[model samples]
Target: MEHRRLGDSGLAVSEIAYGNWLTHADGAACVAAALDAGVTTFHTAAAWAEGAAEEALGAALAGARRDDLVLCTGVFWPEGAGPNAAGLSRKHLRASLHGSLRRLGTDHVDVYQLLRFDYRTPLDETFLALSDLVRQGKVLYVGTAEWTADQLAQASAAARRFDVPLIANQPHYSMLWRVAEAQVMPVCAREGIGQFASVALAQGVLTGKYRPGHVPPGSRAAAGGEARRSVWPLLMPDLLDRVGLLRGVADDAGLTMAQLALAWALQHDTVASVITGASTPAQVVENAKASGISLDLDVLTRIDQLLGSFVQTDPRLTWSPPATG
Candidate 1:
């Protein structure tokens, strides 16, 4: 697998990071497939399956050297009934990191991220807590997910003051969703922060399995749960129609729709890694191949022309928490 520097940090992560968001049940076999494919980074969240994700990941990676993997987990999701159990406050951050470490059976994670920006917490408090973790050798680098341009600037400033490593920002990025280009990319490019792009397959829509009139049984959207809600906006007939045209593009290039979409996302310089999910080990192998295929100018232009108006490039579409409660 190809490797790139994560933001301005000295660390290098696999271009394709194996993520466990909805695939917690896939367990060690799925993770082993990624490892065999040369995926050194494994990303999960404490909130994923209520920490079962971390436990499974820990068991899977037990045989590998700790220093060889980039293990990442998140903070900020409500872990309990306590008022301080969720936000970026020092208490929650400290408690969460310790719990994550214990669950993962590791001393330190390569990257510890905030699941989302906590508008209710002061930036200084969050940054300082992260700084303390870094000093204590619990978290090597800090990152945030779905932060706006303004929040990134403030985070960089805070990291500077705290003397901590603020390395990456994770966001949902796909051929169908280009919101990051206008809202997060420019600032990240300028500030030396890399993007850990999630939803590279648009929650499986970009896989071309969802047709205009047909919703495949057992598909993400058809499941009628969190995945459905997450991908609800992109479920329109117009978008699916445009997606169908990409089948020709994929056929011409001898690639699957999933590979085509994944390759498209990795083309950007600001993207450090394209995190992908798989329900099976074979699926992991298929997704990993996208890293080797580069979409030349011609194919990219063809994609743009095919999906022209269907692409959502508006900066405002990039979601951020409200500045105040």
Candidate 2:
């Protein structure tokens, strides 16, 4: 797998990162399989499964040389009682990082990201707390997940003011979710920060698996009781037709929709990495295959037209335009 310096930071991470936001219950083998396949970067959050994910990841990576892989972890979600247990306060960050360290079986983490913006806390305090982590040697670099363009700019300013390196961002960017394109992407490009695009497959919908009468047994739609089916709910005929058109594009390229989906995002020079959450090893390998493939202009233009077949005012997405064509 190809590796890149995360954002402008000196640290390097695999283009595809193994994420375990679900099903850490039996993840050691899965994580090991991913590591064996050259997926050396792992991303997890403190809120996933109420601390169980970090514990599971810790057990999974135990004894592996630290330099062999990069462990990316996060904080900023409510884990328990009391106000101090959540948000970007120094107290919670300290508590969470210590907890994460113990769970990941490491003295320090390669990257410690805030899961999202904490409006309750002042940007100054949150930025400083993260800065302090870097200064104290507990966190190699500080990053934010799902942060807006404004937040990124403010945080960048804070990093400059404090001399802390805000190196990366984690955001939802897929054929199904493209809000980042409207702002976040440009900010990262201008700021010299890495954009780690997560859910690049859009919960497997962009894989072209769900059909008019079929819901693949192993898909995330069936992983649990997912309410949001594909962006085009199977019940909607027009959207299903659009999906078929998208699949034809993938077929012509000899790539699965999933691969094309990831490739489209990786096409961005600003994207530092794409973190894919997989419940199985096969998925890990499939995601890794998308790393270096670049979609041609004609296909990308068709993808836009295909997606443009539907429009909604929800503002949850920004239907991807042909980045190449």
Candidate 3:
């Protein structure tokens, strides 16, 4: 797999990172496939499956050389019923890190991220807490996911003041979602933060499996609840029709629609990795192939022309939930 330095950090990560979000149940087989396919970075979160994902991944990677893998996990989600169960508060961050380490069977995570900006917590408190983890050798690097440009600027300044190594940001970036490109990317580019683009496949919409009127059996959309809710909006008939037209572009480029979509996300210089999740080993192997593939300028132009007006580019679309504290 091709490796790139995460932002200005010296840590190198596989261009394709395997994340266990909705697919944690398949962690053993999928993690095996990813490792075999030369994938070194594995991402998970304490909130995923209520920490089961971390346990499964830790078990899956038990025998692998620790030095050769890059394990990433996140905080800032409600993990319990207590008032301190969520947010980036120092107490919760420390408690969360210890729990994550115990579950992942690792002493320290390569990258520890804030799943969202906690409006209730002081930014300084959050950064100081993260910096403490670094000092304690529990976390090597700190990052954020789904944070807006202004939040990133504030965090960037705090990171410098606290001397924390804030090296990455996870954003829901994809061909159909270009909100990050407008503001987040520029801020991150200036702040020396690389992006681990999630939802690069638009929750499987860009894969062309969800047709205009049909949702494939055993698909994420078919499995109702959170999966269905997350992908439902992207299942618009018009959007699916536009996604269907991209098959020709993928065919012409000798790539699967998924690969085309993933490669498109990797095309950005600010994107250090495209975080992909898989329910099967085959899916893991297939996504690994997009690691080093490069789309030509013409292919990119064709994608834009084909997906024109269907794309969501409002910077305001980047958001986080209000603090209920």
Most lDDT-accurate candidate: 3
* lDDT score for residue 196 of model 1: 96
Q: Which segments of model 3 are wrong by more than 4 Å?
A: 23-25
lDDT per residue, candidate 1, 52-169, as tens digits?
8888888889998888999999987777777777878888889988999999999998999987888888999999989989999999998889888888999999999999888899
As for model 2, its CA RMSD to the true structure in angstroms is 5.5
Report the C-alpha lDDT of model 3 over 1-325, residue by residue, as the tens digit: 8999999999999999999885455669999999999999999999888998888889999999999999999998898988898998988999999999999999999999999999999999999988888999999998899999999999999999998999999999999999999999999999999999999999999988999789899998999789989999888898888899999999999999999999999999999999999988999999999989989999999999999999899999999885433
- lDDT, candidate 1, at 235: 82
For candidate 1, give the lDDT of residue 184. Answer: 89
* Per-prediction TM-score: 0.96, 0.90, 0.98
In order, what is each prediction's RMSD in angstroms?
Answer: 1.7, 5.5, 1.0
lDDT of 3: 0.93
* Cand. 2 TM to true fold: 0.90
User: Candidate 3 — worst ten consecutive residues by lDDT sum?
Assistant: 20-29
Q: Rank the candidates by lDDT, best first.
A: 3, 1, 2
Model 2 ranges with Cα > 4 A deviation: 24-26, 223-237, 309-325
Instruction: In model 1, state the lDDT of residue 104.
Output: 92
| Candidate 2 lDDT score at position 317 | 47
Model 1 earns a TM-score of: 0.96
